[model samples]
Target: MKKNGFKVFIVALMLLSLCFGTLGAQAAYEKTQPQTITVLGTTDIHGNVWGFSYENDKETTNTGMARIATYVEQVRAEQPNVILVDNGDTIQGNIMTDDLYNKREGAHPVMTAMNMLGYDSMTLGNHEFNFGENLITRLQALANFPILSANMSRHDGTMAALPYTIVERAGVKVGIIGLTNPNAPRWDGEKVDSFIYSPVGPACKKVVDIIKNKVDLIVVVAHVGMYPEYDEEFGSDGANKILELCPEIDALLVGHAHSTVSEIIGNTLVGGARNLGREVVRFDITLNTDRQVTSHAVSVIDMAGFEPSQALRSEPFIAKTHQETRDFISGGVTSADGTTSGGIFGKASVDFQPKNEIMGMPEGKLRDTAVMDLINAVQLANSGADVSAAALFSDSSDIPAGDINYGTIFGIYKYDNTLYRVPVTGAELKAYMEWSASCYNQAMPGDLTVSFNPEKPGYLYDMFSGVDYEIDLSKPVGQRIVNLMYKGKPLSDSQKLTLAVNNYRYSSALKAQKLVAATKEWESPNSIRDMLVQYIQENGTIYPKVDNNWKIIGVDFTSPYREQVVKLVNEGKLEVPYAKSLNVNQLKKDGILK
Candidate 1:
């Protein structure tokens, strides 16, 4: 009986030993099985491949993909398992890329550079649709990596590109899904054609479910950026929504707002690099044997002073193409004898040129500037519409005094918008003007400076040529435009008129409250930039004039105050806390209300 009891005790002890031995082995194996994968991300590159600004016609300190290449190579040397991804907007921003497409007709320079850099995947940005599907197809063929967008579907419900990609690195299976902004249909106008853009949230959820079990780590390379407020209904904030819905996603790299961000929400790490290759986001991820992400680190490397990578500069085809593009852009339109070629601008004189004209008057109000005048004149001349609606695309979009080149043309007109002549009733025109005028913040007494509505973009604040109107700052938006006049007569709501507007603004105006429902009288196949180029070459000189047709009536501002406000605002030093408030007195105290 004692011997049987001893045997039972010994067997029980042996079982206990085996249980602990298994646990110890598992822990030891987990410790030995850690695999690290490095991810490099860039977004909104915008065709700044040479690290130079086409608008300024000079090298920029904080931009370009060439500089990013050097930083990428350094990381590659340190880490053997590195994955590179782009968040789209890789084309259609700089004239260099545009020239390459229009002139060379070969592989796009951006594609060549990205391929040489060994990009694993890229999402489609809204701007990618600007040139239409042909160029997009050509690029896809040239690219060695997958250009993806899960939310982008064809009319027949086919995926436009690969929805997601699973890449293996150092034994880590990483799943990446790409999402684009859903507003592409509206913003890109007819450029998107039959492609349907789904809301980012739903697309991401669908992709995540399919890949969650197949891959150990999930990363979303979204072309959509963080918004001031996340609207679940619109799914505007794609990155955050994915993080919230798909807990399996370990990282979210974003772009499109041109803003930088880094934060951890729940169990995911989110980061966005600024536009123009000014910065890049890198993720150092550690995974265990189970392929579960054990830990990760995020870093944003600024490319301001980094040396250009030899990989980019040493590539003979890329370097030669870049030089050719530089030379082409440097060519400009000038008179044979260096004298102004007479045209409508000849009457306004050289002052009408876009050189130094200020678009906004002092006291933070809209004023007629030659920049808009020239653009409006160009549109009207080309379309022959009764009225022309135009806006300042960029605050620094200035044409230097002497010569106008392709570079200058792009600086003034940023997008590849085409001119359209549309018919509109007087009421609709007034409504359009009102909607534009509402871009200004309500003025308060003692406020010496005028400012735009903080919630609105500068491009949305449009001015009209061939019509006269007054915007009363005291009145609320939608009721601000009063005393509308066209051709020396009181413009009646029922009056039908032909208006010239860009394709982009036409779409935007259609959505404006009570805006004109104009029908298209004519749509030019030639882009507005092409028209401007032709106009400049044919005229050989441009002089623009502002007739002071549109003014801010409620503000008591003059030339001196206008000068001060313009300087401050253009310098990005304009501080108007009451910009969105109706506090005129506070604006006065702040020396902005004049």
Candidate 2:
């Protein structure tokens, strides 16, 4: 009886040991299961904190920091491991940031909102330097998160900001390298003179080599687009160059071109969101127990679908600043001393631009208008240049017949660009005009209305004042500019002329494109926007007058089908032609406009 009892005890002990071993194996398997990590990114927020357009004096549903905040909160709640980042161009754009917050001393509204949103890190965009180095430093000090620029360095060779930051989530370390656009010096002019910029590709390679082994995943947040904005020989301003140099990058998020980008390049996941918080890029990365990225997916979420977060909008500083901005735009601001400023600064006699014949087409670009003329006149008057060039920045830009306020001025000229007077030979001027004329799509036979080139952004199509010229659509792009005259005489190729252009145009287009060999002779002390306000304030009332110095010729829109297409577009039955030119023939070919 004793032997049988002992045998039973041994059997029970063996079974218990087996059961414990099985449990341990199950725990090991669970630990090795793939874990998902999510990375959220916002780019080119451009000071839309309240998701409102101070220029239009209305609430914008499609964009703003508040909407981004709401979407981010939703993402954080759904995911166990999430990281938030901003790609840059956050500081200066509209009236609020450019006029109000950017000038003030304490916390910047954009930085304040970003801090509240819990941005992990931010890459420095070119526009961030618009207010100069001092403002950038103040903003950096105000930000709770790291402001990173690996490619930018001070004279002492130290990095301008943190090169990269590592964040750990779910035991997975992510190394995010921030690369600013090298062409910042070009666009920002002297604002970026204190710092030195190196090519993005080499700078990224160097950083990756140092941090690749230390982190489980390597991601790059670049303030550059996928393709080069200009010639690559000048400097690398695209993320594609970075990937070529650092193929080990697990993912890359880019901005600055303000276009939606989502694609997979080899093993790396690449994504970019649109400007002004219009979209958010989400990257989901799955990793194994060994911390190797197993799989990943990238998507761009539109902000229109998300509601603005009341919590973010109601944040003390944001709420107060938003109302103050609106007040400053409409009425004026009363200081602590009881002195009010910034309300009706000037007046306009009539609307600057005429109504467009075709929906979504900019008539101002097709011919000279008071809006462009006034901007050019301001540049010419301020700088004493013989000639001036400016662009109709937005299709909707116009000075309405009413009291002129800061918002009204902003509508006329959106960018905070300083005037630059440069000396250009008549040949160089012609070359520049030819380049600008290329913004129009080549008109073919049977085409009803003139259309702009989809690839050429409206900002690039500059119209010249102080010169008489015509863009002949019958001619090719290089030979489009004809009847070029200055001071009632044909402009000779050897004739020297002083050209007034914005600092941005001088650097990005004139110098970068090698279109002109001239150097800037003068720069305005104030922004062109400020000059416009001063001009209006001094004149009391401005009139809309077109000199008829320039016009588009050689294109015939006499087709009866043109009216039908325009009607359809205006009625919303047919979509506005943007991605490609939609003429009457094409519409009929598709059987859309019968």
Candidate 3:
């Protein structure tokens, strides 16, 4: 009996030891496990640092660096492993950046805000090169973090900037490669003369190959979008090509299309944030002791719920700059070019745009309006081109029947684009017109009103001055521009003319789309916005003058049902038809017409 009892006691002791050993082993493994690393990204901020619109002279709630800063701070407090980055288009937008900071010789406020936000790195967008190389170099010097572009190289064969950066958190190394859009040279003519841009895929692959062995994971921060913007066959400036070429890429953050994206392709995680600081793309990656990724998740956090960080707004230089910008728009400051802006630069005799028949539908694009005429007029006068094309950058853009300030001018023509005079044959011009006319959706039989194509942006629909044309919406897309006349005569296909256009349209639409095969003969020294300001200042008071040269025809809005739908949309009873065209059939399908 004593031997049996001792045997039982020894077995019980062995079991207890085994349990304790297992617990100790589990604790050791937990200690060796890597904590989840958080990567936060922003793109296309466009100089909205304080969440204020200098053009409207009002505070915006939904987007800004200040709001992003608040969210970033909260994340940092919650986790020790966090990295912040921007995907560029940061420096050039708004009157504050383009008119004031960009022309000065001091520290850029956007860079200052970014530095204060603790951005680890930023990829250069095409707009970053809008101002020229000197400004880009200055901005690069001012940023505490690296402003990278792997695809850009100097004419002398030197790298333009650091291609990639290594960020270590929780003993895990993350390799972030930055790629700028390869279309920079095409867009910023003569501005990027000293640099060479290679295809994004090959450039990214080269950088990934160089740093893959040195890091636990590979991430690409590219200024291009996930999909192709133009010329899908080129396939050089998209993130999908990078994914195809370098399958080892663990994650990618893309920009330049101002889109919201979150998806997983193969083994790689892809994410994109909306532009103007409206959202932040975040990735949480968990790695094991062997530095292999075990799990990963991505999310896009909207900044609408987040408060603007006072810490960012109150930064001394930023605060001072903000106040100065306000004062400049109010008409107290003189620009570097010796021009005093703001404080009633001119007067408008009437509202330039007619009221929209349907809410959210821009009447300016449906027909010729004085706003587009003013822009095209300025372009023609400055470039000496026989014909000029200009876009209504904003649907809400107008010259009110009152005083015109710098802000009003900015509202009309938002981008800081210069003028370009390019040669175009009659066939090329007609093709270009056809492309612009394609922004509208075909008017179906039951359609109550003409609607724009949901896939096409309003900025791509240009209005032509110095020509008379009729857009027959009843016809198919490529055949819509009928009765195209120049100087009261039908424009012949073999005629040749010079087209005055902004540099952006010249490159992005004419050259990039292969619609026109002509080089620019002349380029404006100042921005088109600057030229408008000069025109307004010199004229003192501008009158709304619509030549009625262009009109939209053949869309039947005669139905009483059309009137009912329009009334409903205007009275807030029906939602605006933005996703697709609104027609009687669709209304009946939705049970609204019935």
Candidate 4:
């Protein structure tokens, strides 16, 4: 009996020992649960290749797609578990799209290059809507990776999804869902007409619910940059709207506003703007079975750091692509000059040529006088009728003449604006003049704020010379403009006049369209930019001269001139030389010589 009991004990002990050893090995595996995810992502590339930027100067040899390809290669080599993504707006804003548009060809060369470099996913941006439905569909077909938008769909409210992809790395499944920004109509205009955009919050929740249960991790590529890179100083992206509403997401890959944020929001990790599309973001994540990420690491790399990968930088293909791009920009045909031409801006000359006048249009002090008069000449010549207040000024683009490329033309006139001749009753005309004066209202922070917002910089810094006005920062928003008048006449309420203007501001394409609503509208036969090109085409070389028409009215409203005399005599105020001068024009002409 004792021997039998001992044998039974030994068998039980052996079984227990084997079970304990198996448990120890299982615990070790659980502790080191192998998983690492890196998303090499970018946004708002806007076809900027070789780090292209014309904002500061004529041209810059910035980072390009080929370099980015090489960098993507290097990153993948270091870690095979990385996914490459683009946030959106990759279709336009460069010469690549211009070629495609002009030639009626395929999608961007940059897109092709990105595909060769291995982009795993992408989203739609507002600019993508500018290409219209057909082109977007074409682009969708060409994309090697899934282009996604949770909030965007066909004309109705149904879910539009590409076959959702699950990428497994180290035995971990990551589900990536795409969410596109919904402000397409406000900015894109007629191009993407009936495509409905649902509110982002509900759509996000739906996607999260759909993916969270099925995968261990969730990554959202958000094109909704709440506070766009364009709005840096605010530190508050308009995008906070979506983030505030959607908390179910585990990780967000943000774009649109184009700022970077490696942030924790409601158990989610969000980051963005991987170096202007010249780089990608790599993120490492660790997760629990509840499918929640417990730890993570993020890094970004610039493509310019690497050599051009052979797949993207082929010389024969580049030369062929270059000529094709050029041809498309030249309106499917090249001008006699080796450059492409757009619009019809020509030195058509002052229509009447000031039959009895002399002194070369009277050496105008303001720039728009001769240009406005010249436009009036063409209008009257075409209509055989007297017209009032024709506006002609250089289109607002910072591109230099030497650097005039396809991007310049597109930026200057993204709106397909035509010229309009509107006839308004004198009262309506006076009201419009007042409102136009109001449109002149803008305040630079440097002029008033203790410090300027460096992050924001000012918008393009426009210098409008055609219609004169004033702004007083102290005054309320609507009351800043003073004593509005036109053509040196106190504008009568009942009198009528004809006004010429660009269709963009005329129709209030993006903003309030009602400002110029009172006047009857007409489309100019050619765009103002086109008119300029036509003018240049007629002449070999070009020099724009001053065309004086408008001037600052109600100078007395500018300040209390007489009160300063008291301050000056009594030493109440510091001696500001020009401040004391009542006649600004005379003061300027007097020069700086003491």
Candidate 5:
């Protein structure tokens, strides 16, 4: 009886001690103010079922989905207030996501994995349209988190189930709204449609009016272009324009461009996780109930940095489900090892960066092959094609300024961009060329701008594949091209020839050639990258500015009215000479060369 009484006393003491410890920790936490709101985010995921492939970089690692779930679990344990968000491109980044949902109609592995992880919110990217509206609606139904978009609406003007959500934490409500890339259906092709993306300004204003005073903070989850090139409607880059236009927004979770921008703009904090499930963005946002900016802290929790999350591992049949879906698409166009001299090379010197980072004008070698060889091969390969051209810039902002890797390849050649053939008159071709050059023009308050940023939403700044041309930004969109030269001679309108471009250019929203509003067109079996990569692989090494595929022959303006084209020279803009050729190393150092 005495021993039993002693044991009970000991248990009581331990329980009391535990309670005291909890109270002490709570008291300490209450005394100090929260530092910042860390917004954990990922973008352009395009369904990275494989998770991050490597340790240091965002390559594929075996940790796979299991690791991601485990990581999220640990993070949640550390800070229960952490809001997990996805910035779009989730539907299409990986073949597993695309191949499964696109090819079959049964289970969605990405959605399943996300639900298991308890993602807070997500936005839509252009690639999401690839599955068409039916699949998206179904996916939305499957997604537990609020799908947000202050901008996107159905064709009939009804909002999707996914609307912006104001997640409340510590008396502060953070309003998160999603906006699809306006050019998604227009630039992507027939695979996507049935939804219209509204401009960021109006869309943001519309949402702001409703949530402004009601919420303490506003966050825009955008998959639109990040940098400022042309203005479709969102103004500059989505974040820049969002901040410029919507001061109410406290932070922006950015994606689409895929460039690394880690800093605060105005009062808002901006952050993004690298492509694939490689990195995780950790954000802890603190706010007052009054809805004005108070304080927030943010970090990109490199997914590779954490051990693969346990949630991903013990997710009760998730691995088996994923394996089933993965094995289903094994026979499709998606396959491992695109092939190379050493490892898997998506393409040769012609690394196709979906964004401007890799195969960019700054990364001169790939840029040279991107335009020159792409155009040259298309022109030469097609006897009837008049001129072949390729566009470099994109509306999406965060193309990584680093070595070309799987993600680089993924970003550069994002779409199932097939070669499109069209017969356009020389006059029509020149008009097209002008459209490309006009991408460089900066619109003043008076001069009208395209409803969208050309390079970003889609490739509006086209460099002729087979012809050399100059831009007279002085002219309108139809008249921008001048001194149209083919092989050093002035171009003739009557020349009967076929022009080639990605299938995306054929869409009615964007004009490329025969594919535009034309019922009849030839779709190449080879991907656009396949041709370019094959050319480089066969040609060995590549040099920039070869054969002078094109030269800036016109408009030299400055600042506001003139083009924002920053010469790479020792100028204050970019450190390098603007036109000098570069390699992967130099390109990485320059970061995202303007």
Candidate 6:
């Protein structure tokens, strides 16, 4: 009886103590003055550390981690309570970065720079898994900050990453929950096969449920950007959807679209930065004495003209590696002066100059272009596929006539997509062409230029080689391809042919998104970039000329905007054959047409 009475007393005493402790902590927190915190973030940095463009082998004014470092220092100096964060896609864009990445060595320059920047936390972008799960794990281990991704899980249902992390500052707890794009598995293919992605809305809700009561403030660092509506068919994981789904989230940082966004989405504060470390999105948050978020302001700090820190540049290890990369890119492989044989020594007796040709001409009227020809030639020689499909990655991509180096290689091919050979029926090939043709808007009388479908990205429009075809823009979307020919013979719908394409285009998950159909025949571990490099190394010189295989069938040449359109094309204002019509309107508004 005595023992039972003693046990009851102890339990009651413990409960009383816990209650008082909570009340005391709350009272003390309420008594303190409200603290203000500044949150600075960067997204989709894409391996830009030196403010350098490897394609052009020159420094650009817009990007670099060094500039971001200076900005971060400036922000920290002003606000002692500042916390730095990164939204993902940090690695794997530049040539130097790719060189190190392909090595799979522990020495990652991008991660090294991020650590130096002192990031608090980061989320995963789809591109982070491009090198595969193992490499991503290695990269994640290198980060001093917690890399968060709540939606991703192993096939066995174990969390691939932490859902949220709470950091305490000035007696207040701030919870940061991360959500990656749910469409990752579709785009990254086998690279993310072992993982499952949860719907972002549910994932955000799950994290919020776990962290809401524990923290004074909640910040969502999601790789998904803001979009008007949820695209279930395309698997879009937009910020607006999360804000709609989770009311407990206080602030949101978003990326993956590479769009500069800073605006209030309902009651939540949201923002994103441009690609390649060009700028940083800043959020200044104010809290009440009770530790509730009161007001938040957001802005973008452009990195242009921001000087890089000499200390960072002078870091011995990074400096040495960077210099080696520069040298490798600048060095000539094969020249007329009888340089050491890298491949086919001096195959072209004369220097190969890439002619700047207008892209996106309507079918039947399409002219052969040096750009498409060069890419097609490389694909044909490497894949040996009967037909090759290639896209114009960039309108400005060009290789000078005098010399070609690693820089030129990246210039021509911006992505590190692996080569794929897929068996496709002639009907499917035509359907693919039709899908590619959808990239361009129909030519209208008032339309000053051949504009692109604003809904589609430029990289989706593919130009083909090893086959001759005509595209009629006047026809309906699915009926664009006509007069298609293979080896000077009319292509029949039932005929089967091997087509060379990139892994991104051939991805089963991506094919559904793109509405392309094909049967995979073979895939190579070899990257198209490496293939191009090897081809150049073998053939000492490249002679790029178009076969005039594809043409645009119908364009209203008599349109009132003809002269102005021609002028724009000549001046290179029409960089993308299919640009948004807004671009045309802008030119007219600028009086460039008059």
Best by lDDT: 3
Error of 2 at 213 (Å): 1.3
Clash pairs detected, candidate 2: none
For model 6, residues 442-481, the per-residue Cα lDDT tens digits are 7643444455676676667788888888877667687888
Judging by TM-score, tell me the better candidate of 3 and 4. Answer: 3
Residue range 503-562, candidate 3, lDDT tens digits: 888877898788998799998988898899899989998998889898888776677788
**Per-residue lDDT of 222 in model 4:** 70
Q: Which candidate do you rate higher for lDDT, 2 or 4?
A: 2
Q: Which RMSD values do the candidates have, in order?
A: 10.5, 7.9, 9.5, 12.1, 10.3, 7.9
Candidate 2: count of backbone clashes, pairs at least 3 residues apart or interchain = 0
Q: TM-scores across all candidates?
A: 0.84, 0.89, 0.90, 0.66, 0.63, 0.85
Q: Cα lDDT of all candidates, in order?
A: 0.76, 0.86, 0.88, 0.53, 0.57, 0.75
Ten contiguous residues minimizing lDDT sum, candidate 1 = 339-348
List, in order, the clash count of every candidate structure: 21, 0, 0, 40, 69, 17
Report the backbone clash tally of model 5.
69
Candidate 6 Cα RMSD (Å) = 7.9
Full candidate order by TM-score, most accurate first: 3, 2, 6, 1, 4, 5
Local distance difference test, candidate 2 = 0.86
Model 4: CA > 4 A from native = 1-32, 50-59, 158-165, 228-238, 274-279, 288-291, 299-310, 315-319, 326-466, 491-528, 547-594
lDDT of 1 by residue, 67-164 (tens): 98988888899888899999998987876665445224467788889998999998988788877787778888989999999988899988889999
lDDT of 1: 0.76
lDDT of 4 by residue, 379-406 (tens): 4443333244432222233223343333
